[model samples]
Each structure stands twice: as structure tokens, then as C-alpha cells.
Target: MINVRSREFAVPFLQRLIQVDTCNPPGNEHKLSVLLQDVLRETGIASSIKSVEQGRSNLEAVITGPGSRKLMFCGHLDTVSPWTTAAGRYPPHGAVIEGNRMYGRGTSDMKSGLAAMLLAAASLHQDGIRLAGDLIFLATAGEEVDSCGARLYADQSSLAVLDGIVIGEPTGSRVAVGHKGALWLRISLFGRSAHGSMPQLGLNAVEGMMEVISLLHRHALEWQEHDPVLGSSSLSVNKITGGVQTNVVPDHCTIDVDIRTVPPLQHGPLRREIEARLQEIQQLHPDYRYQVEQLLDRGVVYTDPAQRLITTALEIAARQGGAGDAILQVQGVPYYTDGSVLHDNGRLPVLIYGPGDHRLAHQPDEWVDIDDYLASIDFYRELAIRFLGTAEE
Candidate 1:
């Protein structure tokens, strides 16, 4: 049996995981999934890997208990592409250790959290602890670009038995009760092409898109609703492109909009509102033809602070000692996780807690503190044992 709690076992495991390059444009997560499966097999745990795409996959390993209740520990296996310029000091997959931090592409953004959860489950099995409920470890793919693996699993799997979910996202070892939703949209406007000099001959799509942009800016500002934990909703037009060249009057214009939503804001209604705005534009300019495509939609995920899952986690953290009183408080992250999909429309109580600084996610030289990484394994292990309870209890 491996001493999963020891730094020798935990740190090297994370380093090996980070060494697997699962960057999201290609998102070759199958490699990491295979590695995890081998580790689980060595630990005497059975695991299965499912392919989400040609190169991406998800891994699942469960430790069966005596009862029907189930708890899941979920984390993503993909990371954003590393900086290609000289700005990056460490090799993205080197998993280099300096002092107390492990530097790599996915180290802080989450390979550490995934490693901690896997090791925690291994530790429980090694110690011969039997709980009243099942413990599940899930590693997903494509969270950085789109939650393809999570969405696939949520759509195909039966979530009826799950009592709670813990998302191992980078939360600096603090407990996060929820996170904002993401609504990504691609709006394209089409018009007739004409010579640049004779602009009057063509219906200018770029000019029409400018009007749409103004409307979106005003519409975003009109939202006043706010949640105490999640704060206010936000909208940003992150990317826009139009025209083939300076000489041609381009017939097409496209803009990508990212909207982060909190509670009391349903994505369906928001999408309808935008469509209505487009209709109003069409009413004014009959030639203003446009199409709106939903690129991605992830619902807001919030579990009540009073939920047993959360309270128990807080109690365990308080006992473990680290962030002090602040760790006990309920908080929310701006970024969405697999929980957004796995929450089953808020049916499952989800807890977002993990090692490393979220601020470092996606940044160059991303690293996770070694101490926090090890402590997270302890936290997850203890939380599982306490929340699931022993068969005797």
C-alpha cells in the first residue's frame, strides 16, 4: 500500500500528472486519463475511462460503500495553452519544483487538485476505511475551452444517487459555495457586398453590427439584480471581426460576447431578450439580417451554506487548521466549473474547494504551493470519512 499522505507519494504524483500535456485547444486528456487509470490500478482501485472526443476523455473511479448515498469529487484535466513567448520562465510541462511551489501549466489551475482527490481516495482505500456511502473520483476534459466532458457525462449518466459534489477547482484551499454561470454567444450580421468607394450600394453589416454593439452595451448596463454571494452579472464583448480587407465593403461581421450571470437570471430569458433586441433592429432596418448562435451555456451553481455537505466541510477545515476563520466563510468564484453542469439544475449540493491560488490560473509560471497540495489531500480524505460516516455509525 502506498503512503498517499506522504509528500514523497503526493508531490511526485502531481508532478507526473503535470508532465502530461493536456492543453485545451487539442485537449489530449486521454494520456492523463491513462496515467490516472494505471495509478488507480496499482492502488487496487478499479477505474474506467470514457472518450468524449477523439483525443479527450474522462476517468471515473469509485470506492463502494454499504449504502446508497454517493459523493463525487470532480476536477478537469485540461489547462489553457502556455505562453509561447519569452514571458514564460518555466517549461509548461517541466513540473519543476522551486522552494515550496511546483511550476507547470496545470499545476495551480488544477492538476494538483485532481492529484489530491485521487490520492485522498487511495488513502481511504489503503487505510481500509469503509463508509456508509460511495465515494467517486471524476476527472473531466475540456474545461478550459468548453465543458464537453462534463456536459457529456451529465447528459448520459443518471445523477439520481448523488448526494453531493465537490469540485476541485483552484480555490486557495478555501471553501466556495458557488460560482457564476457562463453564456457565450456568437452574433453574425450579413449584408450585400459592394465596392468600398460606392458604400451606398451595399447594406453595411459592420455599421449595423456597430448599432448592435451599442444596444448590447446599454442592455448590459440595465441589469441591476445582484446576489449577495455571487455579486452582479457582467457582459463583455471579447472578440469582433469584420471585413475581408480595407478596400472591400465586407458583407459579414461577427462578435463573440461573454456574459457571466448570477441567480435570478435565467439564460433562456436573457437569450430571448437579446433576440428581441435584434428584432427591434430588424424592424427599423429591414435589411439588417443577423443570426445569433449559442456557443456555450453553463448555469449558475449555488449550494446553500447550511447544506450538510458544506457545513461538514467547513467543520473539517476548521479542525485541520489553515486559513483560520476566513476558510469557514461561504464564498463564490467568478469562474464556472463542472459543478455548473453536474449540479443537475441546483439539485445537487456542490462544494468548490481545492489547493492553489485561482488568480494564477492560466497565467505564465503557474504554480501550486506544495503544503496546500498535501493539506488538500487530508481535507478531502477527512471530509469523505466524516460526511459519509463509517458503516458502524
Candidate 2:
């Protein structure tokens, strides 16, 4: 097995990334982009930062060569809100290392992967390792919210020619070929307001919404579409709001349902099914009307298993981690990422591989095993070597 302990700069770079506090809701990725841009500058690599929204920016750096084949590395800069662990052992921004683990907000959710990509690419640039294709590094903003940075990049015509892309999402050193998408919908229920004392006089919107929720669950269970690797899709009512006062019957209710969908499933049919279910609820209650709105519909993304990127990642994982540690396999997680944007819009193939456990994402005192972190530095470094051949090789 290859020893990565000597890669002294990777952990410190990740520590600096975690300390920047690019917490979403007000994701100030522009600040971090400036810092990253400075690092690229010191490597003598040209880069550009484009603003996605106020205080949010996307950084793109290209290491161009004489070849037309292009490969890109992507990592999200925004992170979820800070949290305290159940044991109350560490602060979110502490970036503390105990034994072989580092705990902090965004530490696992993905500053570490971002750091690995940045450092690997920077090292390549500093060493002047020429390749057969252009090497593009993209640090995206608003990945935790809307993937605005990815959408921005997808709009550019220049990137349509990319041969492959690797998203540095926390994958625990595994290579993920695909993941489920999210169809977040908000449904509104309406009813006649009446005094709570005389409930029979008016319909209750909350009760109507409850019925709709039940119907949603029933349909979700009956839906036969399931991915072999991703398993069956799922629906859950994550949020519900209604009722202004206890004395008066509520006239309105709003509930948000999150549906995790597998790729190859058309989102149109699901949306239509939801509408039909809502219509059924409305028809049963003549006095009540229902409304539905799509809050978000991020599509599922999958790179074909036959793609060179997948084969190469598996090969690299095997070579770097040896037989026991590198358990690289084709798998899917129940989450949406900027890869959805690239796959759906730009028609690009994206592979997800990195350190850190996905279970720790958004958790209090989130942490990554230092060994995994160091292992990923080797992963990214070797991946670059395999994708973009070195001069001596």
C-alpha cells in the first residue's frame, strides 16, 4: 500500500478550507474563491472567478495542453449549517484533529475533497506535468442550496466538450457512479374557515392535507419503478404548516414532500402522478380546493458503467489502497448534487469519489478519518496521473 503520510500539505489545506465557513443561506464562496485563486496564482496557473449571486462565486482554472480531450474536477464550496455533536465533543468550525480524525463543519461534507482536488491540480501545475487533455478545476457555489454555480457552468458553451468530470463529494474513498435526485414539492390545501367549536360548519385544511399525505405515501409505496443499484424511490412529508389559531378552523395548509428518484425515471410522470393524487383529494372534498407547486426538481445523474472514468477510478482505487482497503464499486446514494446539472444540461459524464463518510454530512461535529483524507490525496493525485499522463511516463 502507498503511504500518504508524507503529503504534509493536504491536511493543512483542508483545515484552511474548513475554517473559511462557507455556510449556506449566506454562502460567501467568493471569499474562499479569492483565497483559492491566490493559491492557483502562486502555482502560475491562470484561473477565473465568476459570481453566481451576491457573495457567491464559482472558480474555474484550466491547465490546457495540445490535446482536445478534456477532463474536469468539481467540488462544491458551500456547506450546510453548523451543528454540535450528540456527545458535544467538538465545535463545527474547530477543525480539530484527535487521533486520526478531523472534526469540523464542511470537513467531511466536502472541504477535504475540495482541498484534495485543489492541491493535486496545483501540484501538477507547479510541477509542469503536461497531459493529453485540458485539466479543468471547478469550485462551485450554492451546491448546498440550488447548484447555481453548476448551472452557471452548464450554460457555458466552452465546457460542452468535456470527456469526463469527477465530483469531489464525500464518498468514503469509494467511487460512486450515480445517485438519486430530489423532487421537492410543496402542496397547499384550502378549506372554509370556521370556529373550532363548530367544526362541522367548515372544512379543515389540515385534515385535507393529512389525507393528501396519506395518498402520497400510498402511491409512493405502489410505484414499481426501482433502480437495481439505487433501490426503490421514496417519498416523505418533511414539512407541514397550517392553522393560525386553535379556536378557528384552519383555512390553509402547506406541506412539503421530498421524493428521492432514481435516474432513467422520467420526472414528468411523477409530477403528473402527484397532481392526480392532489386532484383526487380535491374531488373527494367538494368544499375544499388544493394547490401544488414544485419547489425544486433536481434530476438524477448517472454515468454509464462502461465509461473510461469509472474503469479508471476503480483501477486507481485498487492500486493505491491495495486489496483490502480500496472497496471501489458501482453504487448510488440518496442525494442530489451538481452532477445532476452537468449530466442533465451539459450532457457530461461525472464520477463521484473522495474521502469522508456521507453519513457525517450535515451532522454535528462532522469528521473525516485522517487516513481516509490522506488516502484521497493519493487517489486524486494518481487519478490525475492516469487521466493526464505525465511527461516522464
The most accurate candidate by TM-score is 1
Residue 224 displacement (Å), model 1: 3.7
Task: Give the CA lDDT, 0 to 100, for residue 150 in model 2.
Answer: 89
lDDT of 2 by residue, 164-224 (tens): 8898899878888888878888889889899999999988998888788888889887774
Whole-model lDDT per candidate? 0.91, 0.82
With a 3 Å backbone cut-off (N, CA, C), the pairs that clash in candidate 2 are: none
Q: In model 2, which runs have C-alpha deviations exceeding 4 angstroms?
A: 1-7, 84-87, 324-326, 344-346, 391-393
On residues 256-315, what C-alpha lDDT tens digit does candidate 1 reach at each position?
999999978889999999999999999999887889999999999999999999999999
For model 1, what is the error of residue 376's alpha carbon versus the real structure, in angstroms, after optimal superposition? 0.4
Error of 2 at 3 (Å): 15
How far is 34's C-alpha from truth in model 1 (Å)? 0.5
What would the TM-score be for candidate 2 when compared with the true structure?
A: 0.94
